[model samples]
Target chain A: NAGVIQTPRHKVTGKGQEATLWCEPISGHSAVFWYRQTIVQGLEFLTYFRNQAPIDDSGMPKERFSAQMPNQSHSTLKIQSTQPQDSAVYLCASSLAGQNTEVFFGKGTRLTVV
Target chain B: SQLAEENPWALSVHEGESVTVNCSYKTSITALQWYRQKSGEGPAQLILIRSNEREKRNGRLRATLDTSSQSSSLSITATRCEDTAVYFCATDSGQGGRALIFGTGTTVSVSP
Candidate 1:
């Protein structure tokens, strides 16, 4: 299996611009997760979806950040009016099930907001 | 506050040496996982120790969990240059087990 696939391994966007990161989960996996990693914050859980439905997004910033999972195969994380603070590696992961299962992660999309 | 925290922000060792990383977490958890992330790649699970499991081993890696103390540890033996990576401890807590809460991570550098 190719595991999880994240598109545009690296992205460069000007300040105030928008950035959209994409993730294609492994076949037959029912859960997908999004996380942000920076040198300062390490790995921070952003949101997650199960069975193509958002389960929890409590970690997401209340403003300018949103995520959606239209189907079991794919999910997206979008940042509006990006700021330099948003510059970090956006990681996507998937698992066969939500609990007690091993989760696989993609290489991650490096988003650089200049 | 982070649910989990790793001790010793960074560690370095030469080939064939052994190293251990420790992690402590708050609250109760069903399971604890240890992941390793190489440069430019996402983290991958190295070991998972459930609340009922006190120790688990895989190849040259060993993991110990003390649920009583809400802490866990990972040890790598006979390390090689390829063993260089950032190690993180994650917990599956009250979030419906949908996502893992990660620690600050310990960067392990193994030089040849």
Candidate 2:
């Protein structure tokens, strides 16, 4: 298997600009998850989807951050009016059902807001 | 958010030394997973132990889960320089089948 695929491996955006990250999960996986990793916070959950439907988004920032999984194969995480604090590695993972299944992670997209 | 706290933000040891990382969660979980992440890379799953299980081993790595205490530990024996990385513990909360809350990672540095 090719594993999870993320596009635009690196992104650089000016402050107040919008940034979008893409992820293509493994085929047949029904659950997709988005996480942000930084040196200080470590790994923080941003959101998740089950069967292409959002199940929980409590971890998402109340503003600017949004995620969508339109279908089983792909998902997108968007940040509007990105700030310098928004810079971090965005990671996407997929699992068979997400309960006890092992999640396979993508290489991740590094976002740098300058 | 349910907190999964990992102790000792960083660790250092020689190649032949053994090291252990600890994780404690605030809530009950169906299972726990251990993952390793090198700098600039995504985390990779190393072990998964369900609530009912006490210990699980893979190669030179051992993982123990104590559901009653809501905690888990990961141990690496005979560490190598290649084992240097950040390790994270995630808990399956048994809700929605979509969430796995993660802990602040432990950065392990194994020197040859």
Candidate 3:
């Protein structure tokens, strides 16, 4: 079902610039999640959406970071004034709305801030 | 510290050999899942062990859960080169709308 699709497999941006990552979740899935992966932090949770509504964003950076799911089909994560430390692979996952369901992930978008 | 964590940060093995990865969690959970992520790819689920069950098996993989100890382990037999990847253990609290908490991951390398 195309699983999950993340646009711009790789991205490079200058520090202090803005970068946006896009994710298209699996069809018919009601839950979508965003995560950042790095060697030091591994897979760190950033946020999630249920039925197009944000559920939790406790893992997200309170400043310079934001995520939105305008519809059930797609979501976006944006960073303002990106810094070198913000570079990492951003992963998107989706699953049916339920407890302990299998979550399918996309290949991820590698964001490199130079 | 992470809510879930894996030990033996990295390991190496030969084809046809076996290996085991262990994990420990700090909180109560309804299920523990094992995921493998290969180079340039996203993590894929290999096994899911529930709190009520002690062990679960899938093909050449076996997963064991110990609720009292808040630990779990994933064992792979007759490993292959394609088995090389980073394995992560994630815990699901079973709370409504809660996300699965992932571990740091253990890197496993299998050579021919």
Candidate 4:
């Protein structure tokens, strides 16, 4: 298995521009998760989906950040009007559909907001 | 403060030596997991210890979980240069739809 696949291993966006990251989860996995990692914040949970439905997004910023799982195979995270502070590695993961399941993560897409 | 915190932010050891990484969490959890992330790679699971399990071993890697203290530890024995990585402990809240909460991570450097 290729595990989780995240496109655009690296992204560079001008400040105030929009950035969209794509993720394709592992086959047959029913849980997909998104997290942001930075040297300062470590790994921060952003959102997750189960059975192709959004389950929790409490970690998402109050505005300008959104995620969607339109289907079981794929998901997306979009950041609007990106700022330099938003620069970080975005990781996408998939699991076997349970709270106790071990998650498999992709190499991550490093978003650099200039 | 983070929900999970790892102690001794970083450590250095020679090959064949043993190293231990400690983690303390803030809330109750059903399962705790230890992950190792080598440079330029995503984190990989090393071991998963449930609340009922006090200790679990995988090859040369050992993990201990103390539910009462809300803490867990991971020990790597006979470490090699390839074992150099960042270790993190993650907590599963046991609540539906809740994801794993990760600690900041402990950097382990093994030199030959």
Q: List per-candidate RMSD values in Å.
A: 1.0, 1.5, 1.0, 1.0
Query: Model 2 segments beyond 4 Å from truth?
Result: B94-97
DockQ of each: 0.83, 0.74, 0.76, 0.79
- DockQ sort, best first: 1, 4, 3, 2
Model 1 clashing residue pairs (backbone): none
User: Measured by C-alpha RMSD in angstroms, how accurate is candidate 1?
Assistant: 1.0
Model 3 chain B worst lDDT run, 10 consecutive residues: B92-101
Q: Which residue pairs in model 2 clash with each other?
A: none
User: On residues B56-111, what C-alpha lDDT tens digit does candidate 4 reach at each position?
Assistant: 99999999999999899999999999999999999864455468889999999999
Predicted structure 4: lDDT: 0.92
Extract clashing residue pairs from model 3.
none
Number of the candidate with higher lDDT, 1 or 4: 1
lDDT of the candidates, in the order given: 0.93, 0.89, 0.93, 0.92
Predicted candidate 2 versus true structure: per-residue lDDT over A1-114, tens digit per residue? 999999889999999999999999999999899999887777888888889999888789999999999878899999999999999999999989736889989999999999
lDDT of 3 at A3: 89
TM, every model: 0.97, 0.95, 0.98, 0.98
Residue lDDT tens for model 3, B11-103: 999999999999999888888899999999989999988889999999999999999999999999999999999999998634554787799
> Higher-TM-score candidate among 1 and 2?
1
lDDT per residue as tens, model 4, A46-68: 99888988888988998999999
User: Against the native chain B, what TM-score does each candidate's chain B reach?
Assistant: 0.96, 0.93, 0.95, 0.95
Chain B of candidate 2 versus the native chain B: what TM-score?
A: 0.93
lDDT of model 3 at position A105:
93
Q: After aligning candidate 4 to the native by TM-score, how far in Å is the CA of B28 from where it should be?
A: 1.3
